[model samples]
Target: MASVTYDRTSCVYPGAERPAVDELDLQVEDGEFLVLVGPSGCGKSTSLRMLAGLEDVTEGRILIGDRDVTGVPPKDRDIAMVFQNYALYPHMTVADNMGFALKIAGLNKSEISSRVHEAATLLDLEPYLDRKPKALSGGQRQRVAMGRAIVRQPQVFCMDEPLSNLDAKLRVQTRTQIAQLQRRLGVTTVYVTHDQVEAMTMGDRVCVLKDGLLMQVGKPRELYDRPSNVFVAGFIGSPAMNLFTLPVVDGGVAFGDVVHPVARDVLGRAGNSSVVLGVRPEDLELAEHGPAVEVDVVEELGADAYVYGRTKLGDGEHQITARVDGRRPPGKGEVLHVAPRAGHVHLFDVGTGERLGG
Candidate 1:
């Protein structure tokens, strides 16, 4: 396996004012599973396509290990891609589909057969080797796609939202399988998806991007615990972080009648009269007295529940979300006091959105 690098690489579609993938510089260590995540219209997929040689680089270079492969053909890049649609041949059996790459590369029938069987066994698709794509379940078809990638034994694997077609339960299951299999094979892999939860669970490191620019790159917990900016703070969590641009007061920012305390040194760095305060849903808890929140909806999810409500913070009312015990959630229209847990608040510059303080 080889490490992958994007050295200030960029891609611009003709006639477009801005680049699809702006200058991106990233390093994926050998055998590392790196995930690129962002919202729709973000450049995650374009960056992947540039590496796969399907898109032209308007500037800079891409490297696989020590080799510069910016202009290399896709077939010569020593990479395999698993697309979201499970691009399998309708007429081909699972075995043939898995071995097709080997056969095309001029491997003998015996070699191709051996490799196919090995991959199928690893993916638990041996029983369906003779079955066509149409006969397989969605998860089974995905396995076949994976088996096809595995048999090639490429230096790097590129998967573009490979599990998007599956149902929610199967998506979770297949992602686990894929992560385990990637670890077992020890091949460098780069995966692209719009799902932050999937990226958090599957990737060794995740790259968050927006509008062709890299936002943050870190281990899942790092990004979750210490986001670099407001965008990341708001995006990385399942129930997105609640952000309020409130007036900076003597002790802290104003949250209606309450004050969410902040270190003087932290507020000093804001450079503005107001600061953006972020708090995750889990960080906000029902308290005896804090900001009064009128509960609007409660989403009960067995062990936990999310309470979405409106509260007065600063000069106006705004929405807030809090995670509470599912069995004891407050009903709609119920007024409850919700406060940010100690040391759980995130502060950012009101204008620039950059993080402030430790």
Candidate 2:
């Protein structure tokens, strides 16, 4: 296994005014599973392609285990890539497809057969060795693609949205399997996906990018608990954090009649009349008396429910969401009082959108 590094690497398409991937300086330790995650057109895919040698690095360099590989050919980079579409040959049997790379590399028939059988056994595809791609299920076909990579034993693995084609249930199951498989193989991997949930669940360290710039890179819980800015604060969670630019009043920010207290330093950083307050849906609780919100819709998910509502705050109507007990959700058009749990609120500077000390 090998560590990978992008030292101020950038990719700018010809004639484009701005770079697709800005100066990205990231390091992945040996045997680490690093995930690049962001929204569409966020340059996550371009970053992955640059590492795989599919795209040119317009500036800086890429290193694989201390070797400068910015200009290296894809085949010479000693990396295996798994594409989203499976990319299995339709006419070849599972065994043949898995061993095709070895065959092209001049491995003898006997050696290729041995390696193919070994990978098939590990992937539980022994029974489907002779079956063609058309005969296998989506999950099984994905396993075949993985087997193709495993037999090569490359120093680095690059997977680009490898689970996008599967159904939801299969995607979840396969993600678990892939995570377990990566740990077992211990190969340095770089995975790209637009799904934050996938990045949170599978990556050893997750990197968030926006408009080709690296926003934050940390353990899943770190990014969730302490986002660096308003963009990240609003992007990482499932329900997303509810943010309001409320007027500062009495050493706190006001949400209707409710005043959520802030640290003195945090208040000092807000040099304006208002500060942006953030509260996750799960961090909000139904209160006896707080801001009154008109319930618009209730989404029940068995274990929990999400209450979507609208409330008048600071002379304008704003939408809010709160998580409550699924079995006892409030009905539509009903008004309920909700407040942020103590010590669970996030404060940001209104002018810069950066997180304030708390």
Candidate 3:
């Protein structure tokens, strides 16, 4: 296994004023599973492609372990990749497909056979070793692709949206399998996906990217609790974070009829400027005495209910969402009092979108 490092790396397509990735510096520890996650056009995939040598590196260096591989060909980099599609050879049997690379590298027949069998056993594909790709299910074909990579035992594994082709249920199942397999094999891995849920559940640490910039890289909960900017806050959460601009005056922030005290520094930054307040759906609660909201819709999600509404905070209208027990929820057109959990609130500069609480 190897640690992968990108040092001030950048990639630019011809004629584009902005690079697809800019001064991207990150490190993946040996045997660690790191995930790159973000929205479409956020450069998550571009960063991965750059690491995989599929895209040209316009600046900086990439290192695997202690070796600088900035100019190395992808095939010589000792890395195995799993693509979004299964990318299996339809004409070859499962075993042959898995062992083809070994055969090309001139490994003896016995050694190639042994490695293929070991990988097949690990992936539970031994039973279908003779089956061709046409006969296998999508999940099974994906396993074959993984098995092919496993047999190589490369220094790093780069997977680009490997679960995207599977059905939702299969995707979840395969997700668990892949995580467990990586742990067992102890191979350093870099996984790329747009799904936050997958990144949170599978990665040891998630690297969030946007607009060619690195937003934040941390354990899942850290990013959720302390996002560096408004983009990270809004993009990382389910139902997303509710954000609204509230002017700072009298050393407090006003939301509807409620006024929340702020720190002196936070208040100073606001100085007549508007600050954005962010509250997660789960962080907002139904309160008898809080900001009044007119519920427009309610979604029951078995264990919880999410109320979507609009509230008047000072002279501006802000959309609000609150998560409450699903057993009972306020109806449409009903006025409800919603309180954001104290100390769980996120404050950001309205103009720059940077977090304001130091």
Candidate 4:
């Protein structure tokens, strides 16, 4: 097992005006499952490639454990990469595919067979050892790819959106399997995905990036509960947080007719007449008196539902979403009053879009 480090590492493609991956300093603790997540073109993939030795570091260095491997070739990095496409050889059987790296390293047949069987058993692919890649299901094929990586017993694992190609149900199932496997193997892994849910559920810690800059890094709950900025506040959650720029009055921001009280120091740090108020849908309730939300649509999710509506706060009408009992949602075009639950509201600076206080 080994830890991975990005010591101000950067990657700038040729003719690019800006670096694809900025000087990102991050550390993946030994035997930790760290996920790199962001929207498309956010440099999550580039960061993973840099650590895998596939992309060159335009500046600074990368480390695997204590070894500086910035200039090292991909093969010499002692890392195993599981790609999105399930890069399995069509002509080879499952056993052969799993042991191919060992063969390249000149390990004898007996040892290679042992390792292949062990990995196949762990992945429940032992029954299809003699089957070719074409004969396996998509999930099975991905397992074979995982098995290939596992057989090598490398110092670190780099998985680049390995679940992108699977069906939604299979994706969920496979993700659970992979998380369990990683815990059992205890290998330091850096997984890249654009899916926040994947990053939230799988990683020991998640690193969120935007436009190649690190946004926030934290445990799933920490990032969800206390995002460092407005971008992360809106990005990490499923329904996303409802944010509005409201006039600061009486040490609080206006929620229409109501004054959503905030700490004086919290609003003081922002130093602005307007502060951004953020409340998650789940954090809101259908109250008797608060802000008036004109109901637009209600999304039913069996046990609960989300109310997507609009409200006029200050300048113009703004969108608001609130979670409510699925069986008792207000009708369309109806007006409903909602209030944010105490201690659940998030405040941010209007100008910088940064979080205002703790």
- Worst 10-residue lDDT window, candidate 3: 265-274
Candidate 3 per-residue lDDT, tens place, 246-352, comes to 87767677766677778887767753467888989999888777778999999999889999999887557778888988999888999999878888889888778
Q: List CA RMSD, all candidates.
A: 1.2, 1.4, 1.5, 1.0
lDDT of 2 at 140: 97
TM-score of each: 0.97, 0.96, 0.96, 0.98
lDDT of 2 by residue, 1-358 (tens): 8999999999999999899999999999999999999999889999999999999999999999999999999989999989899899999999999998899999999999999999999999999999999999999999999999999999999999999999999999999999999999999999999999999999999999999999999999988999888888888998999988899888688877977877677798886889888899999899987788999999999989999999887758889999999999889999999999988888888888888853
**In candidate 1, what are the lDDT values of residues 89-183, reduced to their tens digit?**
99999999999989999999999999999998899999999999999999999999999999999999999999999999999999999999999
lDDT of 4: 0.92
Q: What clash pairs does model 3 have?
A: 256-313
lDDT of 1 at 260: 82
Model 1 is weakest, by summed lDDT over 10 consecutive residues, at 252-261
- The global C-alpha lDDT for each of the candidates, from Candidate 1 onward, is 0.93, 0.92, 0.89, 0.92
> Candidate 4: misplaced stretches above 4 Å?
none
